[model samples]
Structure formats: C-alpha cells, structure tokens
Target: MIIFLRRKMSRSKECLMKYNSKKALLVTGERKLKNTSEKLFSELKVSPFYLNQLSEVLPFLSRENVDIIIFGSDTYQTQKETFSELLQTVSLNYPQSESIILARENDVPFVVSVLKFGSTHYIKYPVGIKELQSLMKSAMATQPAISPRLEKEPGKDSSRFGLIMGKSTKMQQVYAQMRHAAMTDIPVLLIGETGTGKDLAAQTIHQQSERSAQEYLPVNLGSLPNELVASELFGHEKGSFTGATHQHIGVFERATEGTVFLDEIDSVDEKVQISLLRLLEQKKFNRLGGKKTIKTDARIIAASNENLEELLRKGQFRQDLYYRLDVFRITMPPLREKIEDIPMLIEDFLTRFNKLFNKKVKKLDPECLEVLQAYNWPGNVRELKNIIQRAVLLAEGDRLYIHNLPPRLQKTRRSAHSISFRIGTPLDQIEKEVIKETLALTHNNRTQAAKLLGITRRALYNKLNKHKLK
Candidate 1:
C-alpha cells in the first residue's frame, strides 16, 4: 500500500492541476480563430467564455471566475488607447487572473507594449497545443507570473542590436519593437529624449526593413529653413526658384522604395506638417513649379524628443496623421530608466574605439564603471558612447581608470566612493548623508539615485528638502 501511494504521489507532482474548460474567457469574434482558441482551451481542459469586443468582457469579468482572458490585438487598429484602457480595467478588476494576447509573430511591437502593460503571457498564432499547455500551466500556478517587462527569458538572446548591445530587459523590449517595425512598411514614430539612439534606431529600422536595398535618407526637420522646407522635402524643377539651377530630387523622392528618417519631427512647422500629412495620406507630391504629380513609395520613420500627442492636443499637429503613425510607436527608455544596460554599452563602445583609434586598451576599471553607472547620462547613449570613445583613444594605460574620464565624471568619483559617518551618528543624519552621496553620484537624477538608495523618489525628495540640498 505504501509503495502504490508513493507512485501516485510522484505522478501528481509531475502533472498540473486540471482546470475546467469553462473557466477561461477569450475576447475574439473571428469564427475560425475562435474555433482554434476553443480547441486549445479544451485540450488544456479549461472552459472559456468567448466575447467579441473588449467591452463585453468587462461586465462579465465582475461575475465570472476567469482563469485566463485571451484577446486578439487586431481588434484595435488605431484605437491602441482603448485597448490599453481595457487592459488597465482588467488589471484593476481581476488582478489575480492572467491576461493573454493572441498575437501574430510579426506583431512584435504590439507584444512588447502589451507585455509592458502587465500582461502575463501571449499566445502566438497558428497556436500550438504544447505552447498553450505551457501557458496554461503558468496561468494556473499558485503565484501567476505578472508583468513581462524587461523579460529575462532563459536562453533568449538579448544581444541582437549589434553595437547597441544589451542583455538588460529594457533593451530586449526595444529590440523587439525595432524588429517588428523593420518587418512592416509601417511608419514608426520613435519617442525618446535626445541621445537615446533614435537616429541609430531609425537606421536599424531602415537596414533591417524590406526596403534596405534602396536609399536611406535622413532629414533634420528642426534644422531646415521654413522658406526652403518644401523644396528640401519635395525637390524643385530647374529655375523653379532663385537657387534651383537644375532639377533636384528631394529626400522623400530620393528614398523611393526605401526609408526617409525625419529627426526632430516635433520641430516641423504647421505648414510642413500639412504637407507631410498630405504626402502620408496620398503618397504623392508635386515639385516647385511642376504641375506633374510625383508619387513616392518611400517609408517614413520619424523621431522626436518631444511628445507628439501633447502637440496634437495643442493643435500644433494633425490628429489624423498622429493616429496613423502613433499606433506603432516605439518609445526608447532614458539612460536612468535602464541603468543595468550601461555596462554592456560601455564595453561595446570601448571595443569599437579601441579598433578605430588603433589602441589595445581594455578592461575598464570597476570603480570607473561604477561612476559611469551612477551618473545620469542626460545625453543618453550618445553621450556615454562619446565619453567612452574619448577615454579609450586617449588612455595610455592598458586598462581604463577614473583619471581617464572627464573632469565632471572624475569629481563625482570622490563624493560617490565614500560616505563618512560618526559612531554616534543619528539614523536620520546617516540617511540624509547617504541620500546626498547617492544624488551626487547620480548627478542629481532623482529617479536613478532613488533606486540606488533603495528608496522612493518622494522619500529622497523629502530628505533632500530636509537637508536643504534642493
């Protein structure tokens, strides 16, 4: 009897708890897909409630014991906001249950965004039983996996961005978004602070995209003259204007069947925005003094440091154009938001400069790397890249040291490396001093420093105000 019971006990440990098929809720209306979804849930032995719209699921969610709620992102075309709102609602109402989005393999951006929004998992289509079983098991766990952000999936490669190297979760999400943008002809709007590698990301999209065989042109809308913006974008016929000595093809035209990167797109004037909007809608434009319509097949990948949505509300941007481009937007995180990626980025830049400047200097000092991590890079990746390159080219030593860094960075090392305290020091005083040191190390970046100090930003702010450091 004891031996027979041991065998049964071992079998139970290997198998997942069987869930009723009716306990599942799927938000899909497509009959074919719904059939497939139903079959998968049946195989997993989980009952599901099928709802067409996201709205139907909300009311049902309050009463039903939904183990897993699955939806297709195709339901939301340009209404990403509504989709997000639905996810938020589900998260609030049913925080314990798992939300799975049934997505296409090419919907990499969509997957990344939703995963960041606290989705537990996703079912990629032509869905298979094995994958579904795995997802089911994860969902049915006593403690469900929540938030797919900075996913450090085992055996997953997060170093595909080449010189923009990263194993960090933030970079992995960026890579996924970039990969998805590259596969489609969709116009991508990159939102991030300056020096966040928006230009690099634009270039990556163009390079990895289907149009890579053609020309890749970059235009800085912020630098273009108001009077000449039209000519620069759409070209001009010979003698069309004072400087139009010969027929010229503009950046948009030059990038036929390719990509045109409009950097600092927020800086575009209302006049240019109108032209851009028309071109995006019609894919056709006329050169100055030319009546003939010239159609372009160029793909657009616009980048900006400012919030385009905010500008749209201010009536500085067109709403229709914003929706078309914004649905597939990719926002790059600031340096402070993903400080874990700094070390790999530093190594990459260091190696590249070593080869470029014909130097053999290697092994960045540990202390030097710590200071680099602590200091908030206002200029983002570009600033760090430039700093590393300079240090690598100028260093006489075989390995990089603190002295190799810039004066501002070097000064930070002193305040960051040590914190003095008395044996009789009060707890509040010690806390204040540590906060000050951390802030100094992070160069007044409250967010990163607060994280380093293991306290909330509000807590750090209150301490700063108390110590009169603000």
Candidate 2:
C-alpha cells in the first residue's frame, strides 16, 4: 500500500509538471503569507512562481514564458507617487500579459483609478483558497487570457460601434454605410449636425479598420488659427517661425502608420486645403520653412457638422479636397429622427454616471423618458449625455423623476401633460385618446405605439373599434 501511494504521488507530480507548469507569478513582501499561498496552491494541485518584489519579478517578466502576474499591495503602495510610470512600463514591455492585483476593501477608489492604467482584476486580500482557484481558472479560460481596453467586437458592423445607439431600421441603414466605409482605406467624410457624433463615427471606423493597431489622432481643424494651421499639420523645423522654439513633429508625423481624424475639415483655409490635397495625393509634405520633404503613411478621416458640398458650391471650401475626402461618406441620423433610442441612451448615461459618482440612480421616470423622446435634440447625443450627467449628479434618490431633469425638458413634460387631458372624457374614450396620443407621439407609427402600449397591433385596432372612434 505504501509503495502504491508513493507511485500515485509521483504520477500526480508528473501531471502537474505537464499541465500546470505555466505557473502564476505572485509578488508579495510578506514571507509568511507567501508560504501560505504556496501551501494553498499545493492543496489545489497547482504551482506558483513567487517573487519577493515587483522589481525582482521584472527580470522573469522580460521572459515570454511567464503566464500570469499577480501584484500585491506592497508593490503598488505609494503616497506621493501615481502609478502612471509603472503602468507605462508594463504596457511598453508586456502589452499582452494579464495583470491581477490583491487589494484591500478600502482600496476600491484607488483600484478604479489604476484600472484605466491597465491593471485587470482587483480582489480583496485574505481571500479564500477556493475563491483564488476559481479566479485563476476563470482568467485562464478567457481567450488571450487578458482584459481588452475596448469592449467593441472586432469585424462587427462598424455603425453598431459608431457611438450612436438604436435598433431602428433607419439606424441599421446608417450602420450599413459605416461598415462599408470601414472596409476600405479611402478617406471618409462624415457630415452631420452639431453634437451628432461625427467624431464618434470617425473613431468607430478607425477602430474597425485594419489600421486599428496604430494610433488614432484627432485634430479640430476649425479651432486652429489660420496662420498656424500649416505648421500644426506638417510640423516645423527649428526657426520655422518666430515662436517655433525648437523642431516639432506635427499631427501627420505623429499619426504615421495610423489614422488622422480631421474635424471640421471644411473650416481650413484654401491654402491649407491645397497642402492637405497634396499630402493625400503624394503621401509626402515639406516642413514649415524647411526644404526637406518627409513621407507620411497616415489614413485620412474627415468630419464636418456643416455641408461640405454646399460650402464647395458657395466657394467657401475647395471642391477638389471635398471630393477627395467624400469618397466614402456617412451621414448620421439626427436624434429627432430616431427618438426611440432616447430611452436607451438615457439609461446608458444614467448607468455610467451611477458608476462614476457611486450613486444608486436606478431608473428614469416614465414621464421623464416621454418628455425626452418628445424634445427635438438639436444638439444631439452630446446634449443628451450632458443633460443625463447633470441629472444623475443632482438626483438624491434611486429614481430619476421628471422634476430632476433640465428646465427645458421639464417644460416640455408640462406641455405634454397639459395636452393629454380633456373634460368629461369617458373610460373607453380616454383609452382611445391615450392610444391616439401615443401613436402621434411615435410619429404615427402603429407598430411603435402598440409596443409602447404593451398590446399587439390587432388588440390596439380592437380597442379603437370598441371606443367607437376612428
């Protein structure tokens, strides 16, 4: 029996070497806890690669075979220092490794801050051995075994990631156009109203394209001064201008091998536009006050709230440049056209703010949502996000009622309420009136009204007939 037990233990050790040799690296200052962790892993039939400190483990990390890294509090604790430098080092070095941190309950706020810096999971220390094993198993099961910064699915319809959210047919059409634009390397022109997320659309294209691994640089052409526009885009050598203190790399140079998003491209002067056209055609440009021509390989993506074709016709923009950028165009639908997305947008904003402010804002009142749907969102998604953020910040309870909304939205709600009532209205007549109001509110769409009323189209028609109203 003793010989058999010894053979079984040897076989178990051999299996561990074959299957669990890709050991987890644990960094901790406490020797006693390190031993405890090792013992726990032994009971779980796993092996750990322990290091006394992060600096000591850095050498091992330089090797590609190290599977996972676990950072303990001793390595991350610093009073006067931010973790930015540490995160940059990790990102520049590993870029793909999964990093887990053992934190304290009180470190939740600090953990959240470091999350943006690249650290993955943060679990409270003194964790049960079972829980630790479960976490390890789950982490290993994940493809790539690393957390991704962007949540968007690769190769999905680009419009679905376009920062505009809706499931309506109109939105689907817009999404289709966005996907087609993303498939090519052509310069895309996005035309839409102010706050309509033209910039968002450009970013979605950048994220979805083959150039996704490269940098995505956004420049607001309308905000740059006319005199400085050329230098800003094409870089400047020393003494290029009186204020050009030293040699500078421009947006084009920084965005080489990547994408450069030009917002309000039509606002650029004709001379600037001509230089831009030359760069697009030749893929090369000279520095300001310099004779040497530098080559760039950046993809161009332009957007404008105003109509560039109209600008070209009115002699305000260069027609050649406009045509070059308009090879693939996407026009985003206004919020008023897809008001059905307002409720979803509102919920998304509220959930985001709830996490941001650590509040418990649960729901937006139905009346508040109705009011939001009725308003013509001239400022579009940007305005809606701002309003919801402000409301969430001011809300004192779980529910966001109409009174907590902006004054404009509140006034719209009052107007809607005033129009919804009538004197001496019968029960059946009131039902019909309510149905008609809902239908009109939904742009006279029967399908949408029926969904809103929680009834089928046939049932809604029956109600209309029973009320003896057309």
Candidate 3:
C-alpha cells in the first residue's frame, strides 16, 4: 500500500480535491493496482473513476471532462495497439487531458513504447506519497484552462471563428473541424465551391494553430503561369531561367517553420503535383534551378474550388498527391446552403463596409432583404460581400434599398414580398403592413417570422400587439 501523509502535501487538500472533482480516470486490469491507486488518491482526498478495460476508457473520455488519464503498465503491455490508438485520440481531440503511464522499476520495455507515443508522464511503483501527489499536481498544471470566450454560445458575439463567421449548423461543423485542423501540423485540404470561404478557413486554421507565430504565406496556384508554378513554389537560382535574374526564395523556403496556403490547388499541372507530393512526403525539395535539397518545416494547407476527387478519377490530379493532402479535409458550405446565416452575415458586412465606406447604412429595406435571402448565392459569401460593399457605397440614405443593389438581384425581388407606401404614410402604418406581409410569408410561424424580420420572438409579439395584427 502506498502511504500518503496528508499534512506533508505541498498543496492544500481542498485544492487537490477541487482538481480531482473535475475528474480523472484510472485504468488497469489488475484489481490490486486499482485498489492501491484508489487508496493513494483517497488518502489525498481525491477520488478517480476506475476502468478495467482500454475499450471503456475511450467512451468515458469522450463523455466526461477527463483531466488526467492514468493507465497501468500492465494495461499497456497487454493492449499495446489499443493504448497507442487511445493516446493518439487524446492528443488530437482532447488535448487538455494529461496522459500518465504507471509503470514498475523493471518496465524498460514499457518506457521504450511510451517514448514513441510522445511526451507522457509516468510514475514508477514504490513512488513516495509525496511524489504521487506532486505528479498529480504537475499533470493538472499542464492542462490548459478553457477560454471564457469559447464557453459562450456560438451565435453570440463569439460566433466569429478567426475570420470566418457563421452560426449555422454546417458552419459550426466547419468551425469544429477547423479547430481540429489547427491542433496539429497535418496537411489540411479545404474543399468548397468558389467564394465558400476556403481561403479564409485555411488562414483561420493557421491563425489558430501552433504555427500562428510563423509566417503565413498564401499562393494562388491558378493565378500563376503554367511554366512559372514550379519556380514560384520552390524558388529559383540566379540565372536559372529566362526571368531568374536573381536568386528568389519560394513559398516553401520562405515559409519554413510556418504555413503555406495553396489556393486553387486543382490548377497545379502534373509536374507541380509531383514536386508537391515529394515535398509532402520528405519536407525537402530543391529549388527550380538549385540542386541542393533544402529541408523546411512548413505546414501545407491546400484549398480547391473544383472537385479534386473527380480530377483524380480523370487523371488530372495525381492520386498519391491527393491522398497526402487529404489528411484533414474541411469542406466549406456554400452560402445558399446556410441561408439562415444571411442576416447575421449581412450585419457583419454592414459593420465592416460601414467603416470602410464611411457610411452608416443601418438596415436593408424589407424587399432588399427578401431578395438577397431568396437569391441562390452562386458566388457564395464573396459575392454577398461584394454586393454589400457596392450597396454601401451607393446607399444614399440610412437604409439600404433595392435600387442600391445590382439589377440581377433586383430581378429576384418578389412582388408579394414587396410593400408599397406613400411618401407621407405614418411610420406606424408602414410597420403594421411590414409585419402583416412577413407573417403571410412565414404562414404565421412567429418564430421564423421573428427571425426573418430580425427581432426576438418577444419583440415580435409586442409589435403584433401594438399593430393589432396578432
């Protein structure tokens, strides 16, 4: 039995108990080991839930706010494969959890295996009660504190993730994936239609990643000339080619220890794809002219508007290269698919362009809002942003009216959705008509009508009562 001297603990029992209450899971198939560890923790006034099997560990980890994971060396020796998988999952998804391997003095084999799994804390048997207490404190100290901003609801001011903004279910999924991508340096491939914010997603991942402090270089591969793509990516030696007047450092070299955003990755020709595959595999490449193999620690994040899977089938994109880049895929949803986010997006854009153009365009006219929401945004967020910028620039008054939008968008305005009013009409009468039209549009579904009209359900009810349109 491990002895625990409560009076000798460096920290107070209350503090240790506070941390323990957050939860810890102790896994071991040996009943003796489980009982000993439990007694040790109990003496320190900490209680850890016990699991006998590695299979149970993952499910519990997923469902609970596990701060520390202590597994016996016996468990590791018997279930090496499962232990390794669990370590990987914990490292990637639940990064805040500290994994400690409990081993005996003679467990040299276990020590070797643990090293391959990365930095994991371990305690040998016959550990002093003070040492065990210290280890627990150290493990708890390593766990990162959750940011207050992240704890807020997604639709609140916290809706923005990096530069990308949306609270739609699809966008929330994207944000989660982006966070996962940022947690590692694995190659990320963003697939989406044009204007779906793939570029922004790549930038956001880099911004949120460990590599944020390093250079973030974005290259639009499709914008470069076919012959110049290689030289642009891998640099060129002086006089290497016709235009290589001086030695030029490429993205991979310049962004060493940083992130490289390869926008329009599908446009890369066969030759560039070969170079990319080699770079992804080896993280080393020779410049366009130089033969010296330069090693780089650059993280690759490639984005494509076109379907690369189809390109792979058509032999346009190399299969091996596709596989290498497809490690962490983030598919950005098109604007039309996330239509409910339009109002919020519009509000964001309005705030942005309002500052840029020195205009205070307060709100979109009811018809203008309806037209924008109804149109199939083929150009996605980028198109909407451009239209908003134009509208803000052309907006003559506080409200953004239909005439401020492009004629193409004007055509989308439905007659039934539009309300006509005389110049001298009372503001209250106009408000009543607008509410009546919105109710009809939503078939009297107050919740949705409130959303469309950009008001709380309570506020809409108040309006209905005031207008006698309830």
Query: Candidates' lDDT values, in order?
Result: 0.73, 0.70, 0.78
Sort by lDDT, best first.
3, 1, 2
**Candidate 3: deviation at residue 289, Å?**
1.7
Q: Following a full C-alpha superposition, what root-mean-square deviation does model 1 have from the true structure?
A: 14.2
Which digits, one per residue and each the tens of the lDDT, describe model 3 over residues 340-423? 899999999999999998999899987788878767778989999999999999998899988999998887666757789989
Give model 2's TM-score versus the native structure. 0.58
In terms of lDDT, which candidate is stronger, 1 or 3? 3
lDDT of 1 at 428: 84
Candidate 3: where are CA atoms >4 Å away? 1-158, 418-470
Highest TM-score model number: 1
From the highest TM-score down, the ranking of the candidates is 1, 3, 2
Which candidate do you rate higher for lDDT, 2 or 3?
3
TM-score per candidate: 0.64, 0.58, 0.63
Q: Which candidate is the best by lDDT?
A: 3
Residues 1-470 of candidate 1: C-alpha lDDT, one tens digit per residue: 00000000111211223322236787776888787777787777777677888767766765665667777656655567788777765553344456777667676466557665543566677667677667766555532322222122334454756335666667767776665566467789999999888888888877765577799899888897877878889888999989789998888888878899989888777777778888998999888788899899999998889988789889988787777677568888888888878877877777788889998887888888888888777898888988998898789978999888999888767744787787999998888788877776777888888778777779878888888887
In model 1, the Cα lDDT at residue 87 comes to 77
lDDT of 1 at 11: 14
State how far residue 35 of model 2 sits from its true place (Å).
69
